[model samples]
Target: MLDPISILNLIDDVMYFPILIIVMAIAGLYFTFKTRGVQIRLFGESLRILLEPPDKEGAVSSLQAMLVSTASRVGTGNIIGVSTAICLGGPGACFWMWLMCIIGASSAFIESTLAQIYKQKDHKGHAYGGPAYYIEHGLSKPKLAVLFCIFLILTYAVGFNMLCSFNLQSTFIDYSFYNPTTTPVIIGAILAILTGYCLLGGGKRIIKITSTVVPFMGISYVIIALIVIIFNIYYVPSMFELILKDAFDFTSIFGGLAGSCMVYGIKRGLFSNEAGVGSAPNASASANVSHPAKQGLVQTLSVYIDTLLLCTATALMCLSTGIPITPAVSGAPYVQNAIGSVFGPIGPIFITVAMVLFAFTTLIGNLYYVDNALIFLNGKTKPSEKFMRIFHVCCAFIVFIGATISMDAAWAMADITMGGMTLINLPVCMLLGKIAIDCLKDYEKQRKMGQEPVFKAESIGFEKGELDFWD
Candidate 1:
């Protein structure tokens, strides 16, 4: 009889493999065309507006939203997930990863634009929205919205948290001086305390924390990776050649196994940037921007930063160091070994610091996503402080347990939920793509007219005041 993990793996193989891949590719291309390649055409505007201060009084700046979401995207997935893709799929997987990011940027723009279009103002005057809000309000399908929220909470908030916790614990324990048993427990306790403190303050606090941490941590890691890459500058051309060749080469690094390249590329790419999977929209909806399309454009840049910049940095480091790609030496350990080969004694220590920051920020960012889901389920009523406190405590406990558990089971559970969540999100984004397209058109028109763009639901055929905050 198949155990639970085996069952989940089988279901994932059947459900997520070609179906999700094809759908995501189609959705990305369709959104790109529908919006006239907004991700590329408006690239300068996205960066320009990203630097603009928070204009609206109630919501976080678009930059804050991007950073918070980036905090989640740039986690163990970039480090460990990239390594897994190379180990299973070969160096060519990096090319596919880049392809997914470029194509999927359009999907990010569409969903994020729709998220802002349909966003609601809580009683406290703070904004919150995501696929759930847009699905119900934009599509008038509350049941499907509820189902999406459930899957999102399960996949991101709980399942992915466990996976991150386990990764963080294992990396530290492997490198630390203490006994593995006691070290994990101590780490778990510290994680719980720190996470609990952040969670207690709610969304505003999370934005503040992530905005500060994301840039510092991201730049620091990239700097380290760049140093390694510069040292191996001569190998740069060969690395690029191998990646491109292996991507299309029929024989593969392991004879006739080239197909795994596409599979792992798409899988790890989705895990890394989270472009069409509907997660970033949750954070994007919280931004206060002159136009909904502004946040959308900002989010499109995030996919590039995550996969093209950070994940690529990790891949180049490993490939440049000539780390043997073997199953026995993969994931975080593979990254550690590569860094160790470059910098010697400081390698594991550097990775430990990087993983801790990456994983911790992911934990907080994920908690915000789940918090929005809980808010949706609880209706428009403001959750009492006590209820939120209980929720925070539960999150802390999950982090603690996650730090101590077996990662195989944790990741299996995450894959099941991630696949289910994507299945729900992809169809909904396609259904609602028109609204975002129209909003992008409106934004462009206003920009060309030398006016700052403002959105009205009525402009898109919605009844006046249909949106909570937008006119």
Candidate 2:
């Protein structure tokens, strides 16, 4: 029998692509106009919040929340997905990708603001909230909230995060010394060890890990890309022309180009930033702050950091370096080749190890997201938490499948699933956005009256509530 996944891929290409992309783009566009460029105006404010997140009351510091969210946001989409777009869509894909970031940033910010507004303390007194909570709390639809949580548990935790583990382990095998079949076994063992360590400390530990590792890998990739870019500095001018040519050249001369490339660029950009997908909001809800808009703005600014800054950096490094980007063998190796062309084999190897690191952090971060959704259902079972560790183990072993599967198809299907999730999330954000604005105004009003900012934790913390570890 044909692979069950193969059947799913066929269905995705035929059905998922058309319906999802159009809807996400339209929603993004609508939010963009409605917000009147919060992404632009609040960009500086977002950075300020990130650099100095208040730490007295919220579940986590604002910076930690942003980092955990970014750890997830910045993964495969930045490194591999950027190359995939350039390969399939050509040089011009970068422009469309930029467009997507502008809008997606707005979407993420709005989603985050809403999440902050609807945040609540769980039975254990941990602050818990997200798109699901907002859907139920803000809209007064608890049934829909449960549905949202279930979808998230399936899409983000079990499916997307597990898929990331597959990316990480397989990349190590595919690009390194280990054989593909054997690598996952080794990787799986390591992941089991690491997962146990990280989960023991919880989201705070995961953020601490990713916050350090992610920026290092991203900077290293840029450094390597820069080495290649310097060698081909003369080719830089033509890159803009090439990108425009592919993006706008509508002729059959372009062979289903233009629209095709634009779609891919936008699709990949959306996938990378994940603003409308509602994943980032879960992270946002964790921030300890009185002003909901503070985290909203910070989360929104992350799309710029992830896509516009980081992803664009990858694209420029590849395309401007004048390496002949081929469609057939697309991925980090292509990015590696673009750099290695100048730096030699070391470039690819550097990318190889770095991607493994980046993917690994994402694997950890996405699992945290998955854990959050699962908590919503099973209500934070020590048993459920233990079970979730196995959830990631299965994902780690699934890494081997990466070697056999076509990366393009794997990513394309991810895009489709991601798009569907975005559609569910976007309308909720738009409708609930007014709530965030009101919350922002309320916080501002409090600030004007010289009230100290406080959140669920400080207001009803175990200390004030007469609760303890046993209680």
Candidate 3:
């Protein structure tokens, strides 16, 4: 008989393999072709628009919105998750992860573009939208939108937050004073309290916090990774060869597709960058941009930063160290040890500090998405302030519970819920993809005409009343 954890893993596998993988690959390729490779072609434009100030003084800037999404994307998954992928899937996992990001960036463009096109305004005149908003407003499918919201809330607020909590606490396991039974509880409580205080301050607080913390931690971690790589520069060529060799190892792929590097690579990539998983679109929608495609392009850049830059840093730091990739040292321990070997005692301490910042920002950023989901679930009305307070407390409690759970169970729950979100979001994005493509065309036409691109719903055959913002 299968236990609960086994059942969860089984469901995750069934969801991801064959069905999820095929859908994601097809959708990514389809969008890449349809957009004429927007992720690549508009790369420079994304950078330019990223620096544009918000039209209004207090509104969220494109860079701020990207940072919010980046805070979520560049968390434990970049470090511990990358380590786990290498340990379980071999050096080849890095190759697949890079490939996945390239393909998935197109999907990110479509979904985030759709979010901007279909975004709604709250009573306070703040923009808020995501997969649920676009699904309802763009597709005119209210029921399906609510379903997406439920799945999103479950995935981000509960499952992913739990995994973040577990990953953070796991870092303390190697310390001399660490106690398995008592340490987790104490750490969980402290984390929960800190998170609860932040959550009560609302979305602006999340934006402020992420925009400040993400850049510092991300740049610092990448710099350290570069130092480690430089110290082991001789191993670079062989590392590349191993990655390529393992990525296409047809023998092992045919033997057990589930255990292959491709599977783990894609899983970790999806979990880390969240390009098409529909989470980033919530942040993308909040950006006060002149054209929807601008935010879309910025988000595409975000995927590259998350997977190509940060995750690659973690992978090379570990693999280039010539450390043995084994199941026993998978996840956080592997990363800590890899760094510890390079910098001695200071290495592990740096990792622990990095994880704390990464995981804490992730917790708040994930809740930011949940705020959008909850708003949509409440019939496009913001939930009462009292209700929000209660929800925040409940979320903090979930974090505590997550910290005390087994790693397997936490990850299993996250994978299944995340898969559920992807299954709904991808097909919906495919249906509404044409609008985003047209928006891109309109933006480019204006750009070529030497004019700043500003969106108007009527210009794209969307009736004035059809949209909440652009109209």
The candidate that achieves the highest lDDT relative to the unseen native structure: 3
Superposition error at 4 for model 3 (Å): 0.3
Give the Cα-based TM-score of candidate 3 against the true structure. Answer: 0.96
lDDT per residue, candidate 1, 381-413, as tens digits? 557889989988898888888888765577667
Q: In model 3, where do residues sit more than 4 Å from their true spots?
A: 201-214
Q: Rate the local accuracy (lDDT) of all candidates.
A: 0.83, 0.69, 0.89
Alpha carbon deviation, residue 361, candidate 3 (Å): 1.4
How many angstroms is residue 200 displaced in model 1 relative to the true structure, after the best TM-score fit? 5.1
Candidate 1 global Cα RMSD: 2.8
Q: Between the candidate structures 2 and 3, which one is better when assessed by TM-score?
A: 3
When summed lDDT is taken over every stretch of 10 residues in candidate 2, the lowest stretch is 461-470
Best by TM-score: 3
Model 2 per-residue lDDT tens digits across residues 1-471: 857676765655553356656666776777667666777865766787777745565558778888778878888778788887788767777888888788777778778887876677667556557887778756777777677766676566445655565555544533657775566667656665565455555556665766687688888777776766787889888888888777776662246532367767877787788878889889888777756778888887778888878898889988877777788646665677777778787777777777666766776667677667766666534345567667655654444343345454466457556655676788787777666555555545565688644433233222444222112
Runs with alpha carbons beyond 4 Å of true place in candidate 1 = 173-186, 193-214, 251-259
Off-target runs (Cα >4 Å) in candidate 2 are 1-6, 14-17, 55-59, 123-126, 169-211, 252-259, 379-386, 389-393, 399-404, 440-471
